[model samples]
Target: MISIEIPRPSRRIRHIHIEFGTLTLDYQAGAEQAQNVADQLAQGFPELMVTIDDDVRADLPPLPCAALWD
Candidate 1:
């Protein structure tokens, strides 16, 4: 089983928002803030796998929608 490690809050983190369905994690932080958080997490759990994916609304790809009934 692949265990997901979630590090506790530190002085660097400002906000953490989580959503249920997709298990979306939203961190209100920039590159520096994120780096600090990752560094903290790495100290205790060195084996943990951490992935960061930054999303910009403007760069999002358009999805195909269903055609309207005639």
Candidate 2:
């Protein structure tokens, strides 16, 4: 029951796609809002390991992604 945030760049690179596990939030809302959502998830799902992606670009090695989900 762990949650994750994946910041994916849009096709035009105009926005940062914010995804929480299978859920997606408003990309234009910025990190604070995203973090708030993450906090909420953490509080709601107390039994799950919670994590939020730190805006790591997709081009990086898979390590960061792995760390997030794992």
Candidate 3:
């Protein structure tokens, strides 16, 4: 799985939004892995918005046995 970490603005703002571009992962891993990653991120940035994208293409598969968040 490929992961991208984006830092939120420090200054207080009326609205906070987070956009995760796109994601594709092994079907075998299931949604649990995705949720785990999202959960971990949430713990670090409680106030920051979190978005998870799991629509990955099977045709363009990722590297074999890739590590999460690597």
Candidate 4:
């Protein structure tokens, strides 16, 4: 049988968004604090250069986000 796989983003919740142009991380926190999750990812993965966007970009073409989950 052939196996198919779906790629998912590494996020604690569905509200978080990550774009692969330069590892942009975004999260929908409370009204006062909007970038709580994005800050966490940046600190946790210091080896990689990542950016945080306040809003999601809906105009990008669909493509492979990651080669490996880990």
Least accurate 10 contiguous residues by lDDT in model 2: 61-70
Q: What clash pairs does model 3 have?
A: 24-56
List candidate 2 stretches off by more than 4 Å.
1-29, 53-55, 59-70
Q: Give one digit per residue, the lDDT tens place, for model 4 in 1-70.
A: 9998989755521234566656665544332232444465477865644444444444533222321221
lDDT, candidate 3, at 56: 50
TM-score of each: 0.36, 0.32, 0.33, 0.28
What is each predicted model's overall lDDT from 0 to 1? Answer: 0.44, 0.44, 0.44, 0.43
> Listing every candidate in turn, what is its Cα RMSD in Å to the true structure after a full C-alpha superposition?
19.3, 15.6, 17.2, 10.5
Q: Higher TM-score: candidate 1 or 2? A: 1
Residue 45 error for model 3, in Å?
2.4
Query: Candidate 4 at residue 50, lDDT?
Result: 40
C-alpha lDDT of candidate 4 relative to the true structure: 0.43
Query: Over the full model, what C-alpha lDDT does candidate 3 score relative to the true structure?
Result: 0.44
Give the TM-score ranking, best first: 1, 3, 2, 4
Q: Model 2 over residues 35-55: C-alpha lDDT tens digits?
A: 554566577876444444445
Q: Write the per-residue lDDT of candidate 3 for residues 1-70, one digit (tens) a residue.
A: 9999999756211111243445323332234444554577599857555544444554534333425633
Model 3 lDDT at residue 62: 37
